[model samples]
Target: MTITIVGVGLLGGSFALAVREKYPKATFVGVDASPVHGQLALAKGIVDQMKPLDEAVAVSTLVVLATPVNTILDLLPRVLDHLPEGATVTDLGSTKGLICQLADAHPKRAQFVAVHPMAGTENSGPGAAFRELLPGKNLIICDREKSRPDSLKLVEALFSDIGMKLFYMNPQEHDLHLAYVSHLSHISSFALGLTVLEKEKDEQAIFDMASTGFSSTVRLAKSSPQMWAPIFDQNRTNVSQALGDYIEFLKQFKVLIDEQNLKDSSEFMARANQIRRVLEGIDRK
Candidate 1:
């Protein structure tokens, strides 16, 4: 089988590596805008060859779109324009609603399967990819019924082969839930990083005084802005709502602290601690 991985960044490169383990004979082609990323992908054995998007996708049995959400928006139609009959197309884009809506209008809609693998790190590029990233991760498959059974089955089996657990949801649910769970976390991290950087003019002081908790909390701030900016834009409504809700809670907490109400502040912290229980239960699952 010939598989084309568009973008060849972290998710795309990692998918190529993991899927190769499952289908050793499968040949991989990479399509990337960056000359450096294309060269790195080839050098790292992430792909057997690198080709322009149109040429590589024209002959592919499967094409995985792992570019930013905005790029995916522009490329999906063109990808469908070049897709071979009966071939499958799937994406690892974080936002699903608009992508799915766009796919729905295409004549080759049934050939596309919309997916978001709930995995990644605050890193970009093919060099940051590792085969282990997808294993044991949760993958959300949206609008499953809209896809051809064969196309859907092919994607499902491939993700399963790579050791990912699958879940199903509509495009609306996928975007809304992810806005709160994934997007909000990154936004909070970025805010925390900016807050500290603004207040602590002394970089050395920050480095010395930073705790592991602060480091972990701020790590997502280092994520690629090129990738995340489009995600926040694509899912703006949901993300905006999530942020508004979050800001309200911050306001409430500030009120408690400003009044020096130790009792209220302590209760707020105690309530916040429940997240630990929630996360622990999820880990147990």
Candidate 2:
């Protein structure tokens, strides 16, 4: 089978590598807006060839959209419009609700499946592709009932072959949950990085005194703003709600700190420590 991947950047490139590793005989074609990325993906052997978007989609049995959320929203219907009968299309956008809604009325909607693979690093480009990127990570499929049985089965088998654990949810639920688990963390990291940079004008001091905790907490700040800005825009209402809750917690912690209430602070930390169990469960999985 030929699988065409659009965007051919970090997520798309990594997915190509993973698919090749698992399905050696499958032909992989890449489509990227950036000529540099297309060449790089070809050089890295992430794809067999790089073709124009419509040409790639026309010939492939499956097409994967791995672009930013806004781009996916724009491209999905067009892809469905051009796809041959019996071909399937799936997406790897971060936010699902808007994308799903936009495609709902299309005549070829059943040929499209809305998916978000719960995995990635704060990196971009074909150079960042790796075979192990999606292994053991959660893959969420939204509004599965809306997709045709054959189309859904093909997507399920494809992701399963790549070693992702599949989960199902409506698009609304998916967006709401991701606001807390994924989007909020990125916002917190970006805010923390900005706060430190503003307060510590001495870059050398920040470099010298940075601990492991600081490094890990600020890592997401390095993610591409070009990619994340659209995500935050599309999911603004949910993200705003999550940020408000996070800010309230921060304010409460500050109040306790100002009072020098050692007992209450200790209790707060103890409660937070319960996250260790949740993390351990993830690790075991």
For model 1, give the 10-residue run with minimal summed lDDT: 276-285
lDDT of each: 0.96, 0.93
Residue 190, candidate 2: Cα error in Å is 0.3
TM-score of each: 0.98, 0.98
- For residues 99-162, could you state the per-residue lDDT of candidate 2 as single tens digits? 9998898999999999999988999989888888998899999989989889999999989998
Writing each residue's lDDT as its tens digit, candidate 1 over 1-285 gives 999999999999999999999999999999999999999999999999999999998889999999999999999999999999989999999999999999999999999999999899999999999999999889999999999999999999999999999999999999999999999999999999999999999999999998999999999999999999999999999999999999999999999999999999999999999899879976764
lDDT of 2 at 201: 99
